[model samples]
Target: MPDQVTPPPSMHWIVPFAASLSEPCQHALPRLADAKALPNLRRLLGQLQEVARIEGDEYALSMPHERVLAASMGWPDVDGQLPWAAWWAAQDGVKLTADAHWGLLSPGHWLMGRDHLTLLDPATLALSETESRALFEAVRDLFESDGWALIWGASQRWYASHPSLQGLPTASLDRVIGRNPDVWLTDHPQARTLRRLQSEVQMLLYQHPINDTREQAGLATVNSFWLSGCGPVPACTATPAHIQLVNALRAPMLADDMPAWLDAWAQVDNTVLKQALQAVDAGKAIALTLCGERHAVTLATAPAPGLGGRMWQSVKRLTSSRSGPDPVALLNSL
Candidate 1:
């Protein structure tokens, strides 16, 4: 007799920005407010909120991006101790020990307004790979001279490593994007050293040819670098075994582009959500987890019960006057 083959584990669909649908998209997406407009999403979320076991709390909703990262990487929390640098390094095929702390060095423009300093979106810098490398080279010696090791990961993400960064808590990029970096700056012992490096890097790039070229081309100057993701690789722990993340809505959502966000949502609803519903209908055991800045809600198909059990549930519902969560209300809250 042939040996029996085991089936693969069920897939878990993780959707970010599920709750915080952009306000601009609201008028353009009035149907989204009507749960019937997005039946797949509404049905899946309603089922999950009604039946599936939930993890994390309302606070987890506040940083949906970091929450997704922590859950995917099996980190404990989004607190400053999240090992974002190590996680990012791993993505670049570089391995760091649990004790090797790291920070992301991203070029950004600092806008000076009345009584405040705003850090523009790093993406708005529109830095090409050639220019990013040039700026990195000019300041590479500054970090190296201070006994730190710099590694270029991508056009926008450079890394700096130092032993002193261990146990230092740093804010995630999501928290500082389009906000005052000074307020979100790390409040650790090593913060002063990191700030000094930022100052020197700014001065070095202030007069570089790259900035001159960018300014002449009407591009935001890559004047300063943001230091974040400061922590060593954390030990991996148990997490969802078969999970896929869908975050196509993030970019437009962050930029507050309602039309583009709506288009992206249409794609997600037609593609990812449609496939998920089909899988569930085919008797596959699957779960859909929708996350906002504050909460994460998981949904799965409920188990069938005996006839007597069904009757009991019906009676109890009529007697208790309790109903499951409202999907639209939940999303609006996020």
Candidate 2:
């Protein structure tokens, strides 16, 4: 179990985009992040006791933050096949057994360009609950006919279960957003079927009235879906209810909207980072994981930093609370 988590035994806040910005985005944010504007971020860094730095390639099926979640829940890292739909469906009150294969299906638009196809973030679709369900229902028969049982999870997340989804390696939605998805596709026989299904879905919804109305209103129309989180219900410790995955920076960072990203960071600095410092000052152990594009650095106020105390003894580098990477540099490396 490499890169295992050594979480401080209290509130754990997993803040993505603390360093996950794209190369261009990374430069802009770090340049603007002076010590004065980010008081809590700087102050919180001063208390970091131990760090479990996790690394994976940017092209890996799973993102660094997803790896952190798998480690936190004590699940084996299988790249992209972590059965996310099963867990999410269970959270949404769907019953499950150990044998069924589950996949999370998110419906969104794929921006067709001359050279590459880009999958937009699901949130960018702006589909209402009613619209999402309608879109799901419209395509329900297509998937059900192929033996997948489908359920509507939320506007941005849909769930499906079928035996064939087992062991099918798919890209994490985070990995492919804002980039061409073809380059990230793993070679799996089942993936070809999925791609055919993607085409069928595009044709099915291309002339549908929802897309027509959406085009009229200037919103991105539903074109295709990105599927990931494929596998059986893994046998492991339950996904922690305590970890707060602060996602304020995800959308804007993916969209390359720097203003929104900075605004989101400002909000996070005020709310999440400020509260984290308060917890530390109160003598409570807290864990903060800063996730970036290819690496994730998890810091805990664990008092002791050692091989036994750190995660993935093979992968970590210890830093004193006083001497860690420069805040800006840390963000850039991630």
**The best candidate in terms of TM-score:** 2
In model 1, where is the ten-residue run with the lowest total lDDT?
53-62
3-56, model 1: which lDDT tens digit per residue?
433233388777776655435645555546654456566545533333332344
Which residues of candidate 2, in runs, are more than 4 Å off?
1-7, 235-238, 302-325
Error of 1 at 295 (Å): 2.3
Model 1 quality (TM-score): 0.81
Model 2, global lDDT: 0.80
List per-candidate RMSD values in Å: 6.1, 6.0
- TM-score for each predicted model, relative to the true structure: 0.81, 0.87
lDDT of 2 at 324: 31
RMSD of 1: 6.1
Model 1, CA-based lDDT:
0.69
TM match of model 2 to true structure:
0.87
Error (Å) of candidate 2 at residue 294 is 0.6
Task: Please give, for residues 210-282, the per-residue lDDT of candidate 2 as tens digits.
Answer: 8899999999999899898888877653668779889998988898888888888888989998999899778
